[model samples]
Target chain A: MSCNVDDSDEIFDDDDDDCSMEVCTKDSHHSGPSNMPESCYVKLTADDIVKEQRKLIQNVVELTKLPGHTARQLLQEMKWSFENVAVLYYDDQDKLFAKAGISVNGEAIDAVAVRGSSGSFVLDQQTITCQVCLEDFEREEAEKGMSTASGCGHVFCNACWVRHITTQVKEGQAARISCAGETFVEGKRRRCNIILDECFVEELLRGSGGSAEILKKYQTRLIDSYVNNNPTIKWCPATDCTNAIRVTDSFDPSSFDTSVECSDGHVWCFNCLDEPHAPAECSNVKEWRKKCQEDSATSNWLVAYTKDCPNCKVAINKDGGCNHM
Target chain B: MDLKRLKKESVELQEPIEKCGVTASPIKEDLSHWKGYILGPDDTAYAGGKFEIDIVLTSSYPFEPPKMKFNTKIWHPNVSSQTGAICLDILKKEWSPALTIKTALISVQALLAAPEPDDPQDAVVAQEYKSSIEKFKATAKLWTERYAKEGSMESIQPLLDMGFSEEQAKDALLEARGDVQAAVEKLLSGA
Candidate 1:
């Protein structure tokens, strides 16, 4: 059965023309459904995912009057839920900022400024030391060499920052990389919890001469975080498929038909990420697969290597590989 | 980058600042593998013992947390008795580039002072720790004395005082493989 893609007009307005054109071109060749549900799901490419994420970020930016980076940070902290971010932002601005590890009033920055002004200054050539590498740099060098996040004033050398960001992104921590500087809290040095925004991480990586592969990894991780956080969107579980499926309708597990076809025509159950198994519950399929995994190897070995003796009725293995018994 | 940061950290740790009693140095000429020592904190079952730790730093030093495990076995809930695997947050997900090897070792020392039985690496040890604090303390103290205190003869002294001959006590201790209670049981069973 053909499912209309126009039902999700509110979310997929920009892709409407493209989707309708594809529908018209593929309508004649559309095959009959084979026990699959009529769930309304839109297949999304990497570009579509970015556009959707940008749309959500733009909505938050307009609602909160915050910069795009800050808006994106809030959306990410709230798991890309525009409604939750809007509600919390309007409800209690300071609480939301605190929860997201954002310091809008620049209290930390002001504190750093005070400390810098009070510290030693030699002949108008002020030098700052990076805590990570424990090296001193001239004011000019500090500006060119040191990097700090937008909301926080804790600074580290660009080299150290690049290493930190590269390691974090490589380890799949691209979405929520915090500032890797320590700040004095109650006279005790503690890690700064200010999360580095995506734009800042990208600019830093690009400006510091980071590798192109790392930037690509960071972009992929951002898309992954967006898809993973959204309840309606799921990446196709097929091997090497970069496309995703966005189910417009609220998934009802009790109905049990949650299978959808990706753009690559890979049919999979959105609920369990398994192959399309109609008439079998996701839980039952999971148990059956697990049982097969546990016992299949042993059963296969017994069938291949063992034979039952007629008189004793016990399974025996021909260990010597001899034809005559 | 790793070598520079690791060398700087190594130099800074040499200074006795606050003296948390944790020391680490590279084992090989290259600064990849390291040997660390943590003097057990006072007022704990591990007191008066020195715990050796095996540390291996990946190429991404300071960016990635160093891998560390106890080389000297001690009975503790958060440390695996057999594998020396530790269950600490900072060593895993809570690791930050801002933290140094010195700080991580200090955390491990602090972990020895306060064991979290709820989140344990050794299930049997955690069970004993939760079920009976006294028995757990006894086993921990015995392990510290036998393995971490630098001498095995000290563990044989009590058996010697208990009327067993030196050769008999030594054989029983060897047969039990440094387990004091097992050695005592072996001597008593006369097997």
Candidate 2:
């Protein structure tokens, strides 16, 4: 597989050509279904995932005319499915925008407005409550008292928001945070997709005097969410390697002959993340390893005492010297 | 990094936990290794037994769920009788940062009251609980009497009055080494 060397180091750039070439050349000797040879495997470095995610976010931004955060909220809600997000977004955009927690054209929630006494019915409904502390800040105090973060439309006191952001960031949860009052409509088991805005979080963290360490963790966690949450990408399992692998299909570990390599000089099976121990199927290899573990204790003892019998080369325990039986 | 928020949060939680009649306190001064006990809920086989729980927290606490284990011998399906490891979801990936030590311990106490036999930490106990509920309850109550009956010995005299052949009772008692539970278990198996 290493024989087909190229000046361009990564499969991420020329995804299809490099992967097909490598897979076909490697598996050429093995006879199988004629159509099955194009192994759609691609490896992506950490930078590649970041670039793709940013590109995706930018694409969303351009399509919806929503700001980066609202686009993020929409994209996250859609689980990065751009087409579905676009469909839902273009259909009843106002409802979709409100659902994505954007109050004013994807801007941060500015205020909770109350109805004017002598009022138009449509604009009459006003007033907002912070979800975290469960406090209602009137129109005058609304700007100072109430702050909204995630796409769940849940608002909180600025102080409470600061604490929440700082603590979650410190806990390596900057990547995934939802409204604290988890009113899960579908179920608790299913992921609550309301993602907090990064800038809002960072701003709040700064307000609460959060250390640089937590902010760094927050940044790392953001990258992690980009790489790890995507079904296509997987962090290279090799210790001390920063690269990630992005396969064309979600590679099943049980499937035969998946040997992929990272840019940082590490080779492994994309399926089980083990060393590419081919010819031996994955399940069989697992069974063999288990058998070795259980048999090694007695095997070690037998190796110490027994010598090969001259007749058939079977291990035989020696009882006495100079006795050929 | 271990945040200072955990200390305040854990301390804040102590009141509500105590209100629930469960004892919870940090074993060490650092508020990392904690020790607590739950008085088994009413009407259950474990009712009157005080079950101890072991808790350990990393410095990255409130961010990470504390590792919890049963220090006392318990016969519940979701608690390992051998290792005392609990299989509760709150102590693992289902953990939310909003959940505090108090809520987590309370959940453990709840697990004792309502054991999820389907998803069990102790399979043997789960099997017994599922297949022979009557026998499982009897044995569980018997264990509670043997191990959790606070300094009280299972008196042999009570068994002597119940008409069992003198030889059988004495032999069972001898085999049990005078422990009422072991003797009862032996006699039940013998029968």
TM-scores for the candidates: 0.77, 0.56
What DockQ would candidate 1 receive versus the native complex? 0.37
**Model 2 per-residue lDDT at B166:** 51
Per-prediction DockQ, in order? 0.37, 0.13
Clashing pairs in 2: A113-A127, B2-B59
Candidate 2 residue A41 Cα shift, in angstroms, is 6.2
Off by over 4 Å in 2: A1-48, A58-79, A83-174, A177-195, A205-207, A234-325, B1-19, B26-33, B96-98, B151-157, B160-191
The lDDT of model 2 is: 0.61
Scored against the true structure, residue A89 in model 1 reaches a CA lDDT of 81
Tens-place lDDT digits, model 1, residues A37-95:
44456767777787778678778867877766677779888988888998888799898
Q: How does model 2 score by TM-score?
A: 0.56
Cα lDDT for residue A90, model 1?
76
Tens digits of lDDT, candidate 2, A213-275: 777778788888666556666778789898777776545555666666666557776655667
